[model samples]
Target: MKDPMDLDTPLKPPPAPGSDSPATAAPEARRDRTAPEAQRTDAPKRRSILGRVLAWLVVLALIGGGVWWFAFRPAPEMAARGGPGGFRPGMPTASPVVTATVEKGDMPIRLNGLGTVSSLATVTVRPQVGGQLTQVAFTEGQAVQKGDFLAEVDPRPFQLAVEQAEAQLLRDQALLKNARLDLERYRLLVKQDSIAKQQRDTQESLVQQYEGTVKADQVAVENAKLNLSYTRITAPVSGRAGLRLVDPGNYVTVGEAGGLVVITQVQPISVLFTLPEDNIPAIMARLRDGAHLPVTAYDRTRDRVLATGTLTTVDNQIDVTTGTVKLRAQFDNADQSLFPNQFVNVQLLVDTLAGVPMVPVAAVQRGAPGTYVYVVNGEDSTASVRPVTLGASDGAKTVITKGVQPGETVVIQGADRLREGAKVAATDGAAQPAAPTPSSEGPRPQRRPQRNAS
Candidate 1:
């Protein structure tokens, strides 16, 4: 008999569905069906265990990847190169910047103002006598000198009057001569007792009256000649002539409102400008000392120089509304660079501070520090904040009264990226190998520089 539990051998058919082996066959068939059920259950259990292991492996792999990324990943350079304040716990990076040296030079104190070119003299040419305009002696916009002929009026009428006066003078002279001869005869007859004394006196009186008539005629002739000379007109000043107001062949009068033409002096012109009343004292001081303040005139943009001049005079009173005073400067505009009523920019150089510590105006910075600058240290490639004492600036350079010394390196551009102590790379490459140490000075009020406006 085969062991009931150890059935390695194949089981026989359930006794061919017959009798005699009923109990054993039925138990074997039931055993076979139960075994298949047990096999199916075990298969599902094994598959479930495999699935759980795979899921855990995926979770572990994800966690390890996150750890590696957070702990050992490389950082980008952009994070450190943002600015002077951009940094992390890593190697330091240098910031690119532009630099200028604190130099010792003279800084001119100049005052700027709006100005206009003006003519020293403007005149209107008119006729002294009323008559028909026979000829126009000048072209429109022509330049003329003093006493240059400009126009002419009809002279025939005045000439006729002169001739008539001269003829009357000759006739009066003839009568005076005849009266003198008669008076001579009467005087001689009276002396010889050939005539009455009263008669001789009457003859002398007649001769005197005729002499007076001759003198009156002579005065009339001279007056008529003077009137004839006034027909021609001339320029009163050396200047450029304007358009013709009265054309030739038109009747003009001495009382004409428009006149014949306008003339304006151009060479050696003047510029009129206004300055704040506060500048009067300094300007007056210079003038009282017999010093001629130099003035420069530029175009509207203040880029090109138009002329150089000297301050001539100041207005008697200040304009109360604008709180400014008018000033006149005379320029030798030999090239005719200045025109009447032309707008320009004026710069009056009042004073110059010499041998002062100066730096580019761009190097000056203003912030909570009041006014400051960035001084670079080339030895260690670092920039430090410095509170500077500023004086007057000439728009291009500023004078350093204190807080900075000569022969020092200063950052002119790229200062916005700097801090108290920031590493820098001087693109200028002129940063001194031995830069001066930072000053221990504090911030102070910056002196308001020159006011450059009208």
Candidate 2:
């Protein structure tokens, strides 16, 4: 009977709820009624949210721990990545090291300073006599020996004076001859009583006076010749001549204001420098003790030695303003490197210390006590800063009088980043025998270690 009204499609059968028969409705109502589905869906979703929150919390804790490790730990401990040997398990690795053998030797403490090149014995050459400059024998910049003729002043005036003196001498000689003949006749007449005694005496006196006048004329001739000879200008010392200040025609006044050219002696140049009064005792001790003080001059800008010489003079008094004493050193400047008034770094070696332990200046750290260095221990490779006594210093190297040994490697490269008892993995990883690589040249990229900014 129901099929008669229905189409070919199957018709859903209607159920009665009060008779305990199942019923189907909207999709949402069906889902709400399913117990297993509700519980299965809720359980997985809740577990997923809790897992996401826990994961985020764990990530934050790890980040916070890493930051603490970096900030609070020492450089060595950080370098190890929170473990020994600069390494941590399952972490990025560090470079391994092979050690170098360190040994003891006589370290010469080199004291470095900037200096200048100069020349000595600069002099002003002046014309001795004023005249027309007749000849110039040397060029403006030529080197001349002592007594080399430089120029000739006009000698015509001097020559004319000499001629006049010669002519006067001839006249004077004729007068003297006549007087002598008269004196002879007067003496003979006196013997025979042919003339009075007064007359003979007068003739003899006239002859003597004429002889004195002739002698005076001769001296005048010599004087004229001396002035003529003075007209030629000569070099007083072997030296290099500078530009002629006064040309040949210019008149030159003699004695005080007299100068023709400046002559600088180029060989065996002297360096005049000053040393502090505090250094005088050491300088004198070396000199008196028969230890020759080697004075070395250097060009500061170029950082090269200009000359080396023996110290010659030490001034008597200390300079009030600078608290220094004047000193002079002589050098064989065959190459003409040194000049007068040229400022130079004068290194005076008071004495040499034999077999003194030395270290790079960087290794010496100034602490509470005067000076100290970090001594790396053999057992744990830990370091403790120990106070030291020191002596003379070369700007690059320092003299260690006490405390540390020569063979021990005092950290030069990484010292600025270290502290007491901090474990240090030597980037070079060995005891260094002598001084460190000259970082005065600055850091080289290939061998440069990452500096500890702290």
Candidate topping TM-score: 1
Instruction: Spell out the clash pairs found in candidate 1.
Output: none
Residue runs of model 2 more than 4 Å from their true location after superposition: 1-120, 170-211, 248-259, 406-409, 416-454
lDDT agreement of model 2 with the native: 0.71
| Candidate 2 per-residue lDDT over residues 366-416, each given as its tens digit | 867668877776677766787888765655557778887767766666666
lDDT of 1 by residue, 332-402 (tens): 99999999999888889888788999987789999998899999987898888889999988756789998
Give candidate 2's TM-score: 0.64
Worst 10 residues of 2 by lDDT: 441-450
Please, what is the TM-score per model? 0.67, 0.64
lDDT of 1 at 181: 93
Q: Which residue runs of candidate 1 sit more than 4 Å off their true CA positions?
A: 1-95, 170-218, 377-382, 429-454
Every candidate's lDDT: 0.86, 0.71
